[model samples]
Target chain A: MSAPAASLDAVRPPVRTIGRDGRRRLLAAGLVAPLAAFLLFAFAAPIIWILGYGVADNELASVWPRVSAELRDGGDELPPDEAVFAALAADLRGSQASRTAATAARRLNYALPGGRSLVTQTARALADRQEPDPGGGWRETLIALDPAWGERETWVALRQASGPVSAFFLLSAADLRLGADGLERAPPEQRIYLAVLWRTFAVAATVTAAAIVLGFPVAYFLANGPPALASVAMVLVLLPLWTSLLVRTGAWVVLLQDQGLVNGALMALGLTSEPVRLLFNRTGLTIAMVHISLPYLILPLYATMTTIRPELVKAARSLGASPAVAFWRVYLPQTLPGLAAGALLVFILSLGYYITPALVGGAGDQLVSYFIAFYTTETFNWGMAGALAILLVAATAILYVFYARLAGPRGLSLG
Target chain B: MTARRTMRAVSAALAGALLAAPALAQDSVTVVSWGGAYQDAQREVFFRPFEEETGIRVNEETWEGGIGAIRARLASGGDPGWDVVQVEAADILLGCEEGLFEPIDWDRLGGEDSVIPGAAQECGVGAILFNEGIAYDRDALPEGPTGWADFFDTERFPGKRALRMHPAVALMGALMADGVPKEEVTAVLATPEGEERAFAKLETIRDDLIFWRAGAQPPQLLASGEVVMTTVYNGRIDAANREEGRNFAFVWDGSVGSFDYWVILAGTPRIEQAYAFLEYIHRPEVQARLPDAIAYGVVHREAADDIDPERLPDVPSAPENLAVSVTQDLEFWLENAERLTERLQSWAGQ
Candidate 1:
């Protein structure tokens, strides 16, 4: 009987052996190809272009490779004396004008009182048809324009201003710069952007923490309530999401402004004799952002929490654990996944917010997005914008990694 | 059935081509310009007549924010989307700097003398109307202040006054208020001391001031009584006064005059069409209609012949209206824009 069974199995040769593998391979390819293609074309390609724009040495694309090659070939030493003058002549009077030179001029003109004259003179000399000999032309040009031009400080200032994807923008975000001697130093008068960055992070974290603390209890109540009550709570949760974000932010502005509804009510109630300055302040910003971001935190948590079984908690209670004990031991453990997810979601969203802050907050309350927008739109500085974007993307990825490590898989309990 | 469907499709194609042949024969053109009265006047007089005479279709695309969108498209290494862009001189200056637009071929368009002297130039051709000046609610201050200084005098005026947020307008207004003569506006703006002085005066009124970022905002603020006085576009204030019957009126004294021009983007596929659009829009009849309709001054001084001179004062097209206005220093503004704007925002923060 065993032999017959073995023979029968062998005859059958395991169902769908050859065709199944082929179909499975085809199915996998079908599932993944579109996503990969979309990422490659839409996201990766443009980002690569932006990165390339940031790194490119000059307007003429070919100059980038030649400059990079020259930098690599020179190693640690400065170019030879002959090569230096040749380079200076080529850089100044070459057929293709340096975009960096233009950017440098623009930036310097902003900083120094007499910088515009130096820039225009340099530009005119470079653009002029009368060519000076390579021997002392650069020296003469440097001396005629600025005595300080020979010093590395001048070049460093020019580089900081021009910033063709140099680490300067990333450094500027931190209020730091490469000094005359090539060491990283704090910005002028020893001012550091660390405080601003810290202030920003603190605000974002506070907003996120507030949203989560407020959202979790509400989401828990909604998730554990009776079906009819849960449905009503769900509607209430979704109500803000349906309203326009701008409209909601505007409503907050109306409520928070010194002479607005909330202040008027407070004053009328004799809560304060003078109208408290509510609009264009930190308190108003926090209140508005929390209201705006509350739904984002709550909705995700609610979705995650509702999936947890009530039977597990009931079983714990039946086994002689108190209600609070059962909740702490069973229900709370299951909601960890939701808590972790909500915190991260709210934190990331809050960091990139632009409109809410601009409308409701004062000048000092502006986030990093405001600076990014200023660079991109007002100054038309794509290189700095691209670098800033890259830094932001790096920060977000690092945060995600940090979050993932903190919330280990075991921390996520499900029914 | 499929064969029959194919046959139907072929016949449809044939029908379309047959119908389109006359339009093609006439050298059809399409222009993309700002929507509303400006576009309507262009359609009624220039485009319609041009089509009648030249047999060009003269289609139009109407939208606001045309220049910025076109520049972005050009920067993306794509073909410029607009055949013709009706933009102001300042926008043209920006476009020229970015290399996003081509210089107009004045030899081909050929209205060098017909265009207001100093209007026809390399980047664009002055198409329709100029705008300048300050407007105020007459009811709020019945005495009617004339120059920028009186405009800034809150003690005399005793109400909220609005100004444009742009440094070009703000700096000029500030200096003029601070006793720099109208002729010396540009010279003052060029110096570091002048900018500082202007900022100093502005700092005093910063609390009472509301800076408007858009063309329409100042007029709106004036009409709503949110501001009792403001520096406004001449036509916009006029239109608001007419529509809302507001007590506001404009003072051309110490106003920086600017003309909006019609330009073609550098890499536009339809150059001939764009030229046709420009040529059509500048016709005197078309130019005349726009001032009454849109409230902008027409570039063609001859266009005012159609409208009564009494009405022309109300319209921007009047030469008397144009005479009192000061032209802005475009090159200086272009050179220092980034620094000035950043400084303005930073100073405002303080």
Candidate 2:
């Protein structure tokens, strides 16, 4: 160690002598540090916080700690002792007197339907009477107030709801639930999230595919055409992006309605006797989404396609290769990086679409983001919303990893 | 070293100024309600008058109906910004029980007997009475729908229908269409068989149904001929007819009436000012002026006595209209909304 240190000291610069490269590196990092810190706090912190809601169990635990503790200790079976009932009585009376019974009731309702009324009613009934007679009558009184108290499912739900963290929300997001035995598929009628997730992906994939097919020709023309025409075409491509998404979707609604311009033109030409059902369906959703997402696909492809020299194709042709073979082997493979970037961007954006589908699409056409908004805004189910959001983020990340694997190292650069 | 210190001092002052701006502006009471024509009417009839009379600046904001925004604001463990919020009956009950709202003293505004029956609650005061009813474009459906049953008779009506997406009013309408009596609707809905029966009845018109989420969409749907008939907020149809000259006819039979109430958030610092504004809006004369401005029914019974006889029929709380219309069972909805909404969403997806 002493020999190596002596050699390093011999080669090192004198003390307090700073080099140009070292100074530049320090300045660059100093300039970027604020932005990095801002992103960590502003972007990453909120995401991590929201993701934490999926595993939060404070609502039930905070309001009815005694009952929750008893339930947790009782395990899977219904507690045979009357002490559980006394604890529940005390908790309910406490919550009712404080007017916080609804919080605990709402938490339990997530597990058992109608548990809100069962809890609130029992609390109100007990609130009217004295402290349970300190006897076996407490159980009978609770059952008499709400017969649901006697049900095993109620006890099961109570036990499940008492948690520091549980897999209930994550399982619910996948349309599964924890039963007495183990995790099982949710009832067929309640199996909605899986189907909704599939539809979200299906709609996003269709939009991405349509955007690519329609955008490629336009982007190619702009890339290869004269400068003036290219500028005009570029402006035309970007004009819709400048407009509000609501306005663009509204324009589609106006044009695709039964009595709208398209239908009027169709009937005027005697194409059909009746107006077609064009709006408020999957067809309307795809058309509108493609129009909205086309610019994303076009810009990236245009950037890449314009960089491909015309002489490359000419050189291939000079080697006696047919035009089709040369174009297929040389041109298409060169554009894969841009294609990957554009497809990933459009697909990720489409997966979180909320407004366009809610306005233009039919009831069944609504996506998972719509459900996220529903749970967050309408029902105030933050846990469910967080779980669904995590699923979406994870899904997008997985897709990105796959794209990266397919596109190789150069794929990171969108251009 | 001096330059760096100065830079730090300036940035600190700027941050402190940013933080102090909102604190200095806290004298005004923020009022939140449904936007569009509804908020416009409140601004004209309630907010402007209250500000003029009380000298307290009123900051008006708009929100679409739901307690989610309120819950979000309160979740941050600080003042929830708004002093008063307009909420529906079910939400008022739920929010009150959850301790999200302050218990209102009805005697301060008027005695308990002064407010309309079923409108007074422990933590909220009824602001308006509204109904959800079938409406049709006069030019398109001249015969018009007579009742909910006619709404379901696609064979005779022979056109698409727009219904609200939620289960509360829609399920009640479905049960009514299936010939269940008004008083028995809640009882019937309590059973699984009743729910199945309602869904089965709705299935007959599934192909013809276009579900709408917002109150404003129904009139637009009817105007654009997207649907021949829709269940719309009675006030929206009235406003469209009066303002746009759209000849839309309302079917009052089988209509379901409910109330929207004003409640103060539990942790608001402006409780006295909030109560004053609430008191001001509930004045008999102020309530009377509201019908002409927004076309919604008022909860002050005496306010109805002040309206012109010609305009009284448009009010949902008119004695004749109330006789035919069913009052919404708020307790039932508050208890069952979570489960029923999930079921409704699943059904819509199917």
Candidate 3:
């Protein structure tokens, strides 16, 4: 028989090791280079930079460079000395001229309550004066200008804010603060974010659990039932994919309002006498969020369940196991990975929900995302928002790793 | 079709004039404001009249862009394209401090005394005044409330009521309901006792209060009877009644009002034209026409007298409404809003 050239090349066994094959390795790297660069800059870098704002304290540094630089070397316990005071006076004059005094004042105000008056009032008084003496007069003159200027807390906040970066936002996000000794829980009256975060986690977990319970049986039907009916039901399940979130949310608002169709139907059936409280509460939020999140859980689970063969359960049933025993022992165990994955996906996605909760939830039902939005839009406090978002993303990333390990071969396949 | 054709011709003509005779063309400055009915009202009264009175062409633009837009322009260091902008009160205060707006030429634009209180500013003049007040469906709560005090009295007008989610208005409404004088609302809120009192008042009916964030939610809530009354922007109620024939009315007593100011961007080359346009717009006759078209009141103090008596109770800036209204303290809120909101949030969650 005449062997072709391809057959002879396939039989050759003299190939070098992959490590020694520099050209192949280089070609492989070149193929991946564009994607690697894109992710590094587009995805990874921005995330890292934003997360850095949690600990990065740079308000005073940006607006009052001289004072920030001076305070970097000074003791936190002591009030800013005459030299630091002179730097501050000079910086305030400079900041006022440059129109940045408000930015610094606003930032300091977050740290020391109502501290805006301290910086702005001082700036106004200092703006009207002649140039500072750059001597001992700054400490006294500044205090004379505003008695609050003499307070230790103002100096401490100034020193704290004078940063390359610090843990101020991160600590504040946890409702903890850097006290005299170190980090301490904020007073009971002011403590908020920890509760908000707990509420956020609890809501996400509840939504995840509910989605699984509702979605699993449907997923099994789609996996095992007649093809045409399964496909149609799958289409119904996925109808939300094309609809906008606001539209879906608005649909719930229509269906679940006090005088809406849901109540009307129930009343007509004589199921209830009065209108039910469905909107603007936890019940409304869960119903809407679960409806929106169900597709994410169902599709992944259906995909995983379809791959499992039916013969194992049949074999177990024929031998000795009852139907329930066969399903529990043989079928359910096989589906655990899919269930965990679906639950995780729903949980992480639910954590980022903002608008649905805002529209459907009462004030008490609002999650961490609400506080992030409040900080961003209402207060324009980017540091606080960044801290909250960092915490949220951190929680999501950890769960994602566990998911990746469970769905190892098809780790990135969403469906 | 004819209107579109005319607009196309006007835009073409304006473009050609810019390219062909850039120097010789009449001075035209871009004025940006919050668009829609407000801009339409302005076009009829201010822009059209100013263009007719002076040979200078008027270029009108509109934006809801906040102070950051101005900051972007400043950073770019070019001709600030928008010569005169209608800015929110907070932006005016912040921008004026930053010297982003030109000092108002009080003499050229008539005396500063000509404008209403809070309308006259260091760098800008108030363009319009709008109010947020307690509103109810006349069909639902026909008795009508005397003041904010009646709003909190669930025993009296007892039904679910909504307030804007933010602490600012709700706290003010609570304090006013609890018998703090409307004029003293801001002063009382300055002290810890005032904040404590406001929250305590809120706590009495805390479980009963429903909070809404969107401006549109209030009217819907009222129409559905989910809420009997709500803290609504007066314009929403006015528009709802006019558009949907839903008879809603504002309890104008003890309302919260704020201003939108017309400010000249600092270092504008068309300073002359800007001041002229501003002066023209603020004329009592011109200012008087705005209230008829929209619910907002005029900025000129004398303009209040010119507004038709029929529209008095409907407008937020009317002297009758203005008398009982409280202007939010920009300086005080800037200092305390964050902490107080945090306090309110912790309280709400509990």
lDDT (Cα atoms) of all candidates against the true structure: 0.66, 0.84, 0.84
Q: Could you tell me the lDDT of residue A36 within candidate 1? A: 92
TM-score of 3: 0.91
- Superposed on all Cα atoms, model 2 deviates from the true structure by an RMSD in Å of 10.3
Listed for each candidate, the true contacts retained, as a fraction, are 0.05, 0.70, 0.75
lDDT of 2 by residue, B1-350 (tens): 23543564366446545554443344578998989878998898788766655656799888887766677788886788888999978699888887788999888988778877778889999989999999999998788889989999988999889888888778988999999998898899989899898888888898998888878789989999989999999988998999999999888888888899999998998898898788878877668777877778888877776665778899886777777888878887877776777777788778
Instruction: Calculate candidate 2's fnat.
Output: 0.70
Return the top candidate by DockQ.
3
Instruction: Give the alpha carbon lDDT tens digit for every residue of A1-415 in model 2.
Output: 8999888878987553467667888999999999999999999999899888877767887889898898877755573357788788888998999778998888888877788888888888788566565445667767767878877778867777788777778788998887656678987767888888889999999999999999988988899988899899999999999999999998998999899998999999999889998888899889999999999999999888988988888899999889998989988788878877788789889999999999888989999999898888877889898888888888878878887887788886765
Q: Rank the candidates by TM-score, best first.
A: 3, 2, 1
Q: Give the total clashing residue pairs for model 3.
A: 0
Indicate the docking level reached by candidate 1.
incorrect
- Predicted structure 1: lDDT: 0.66
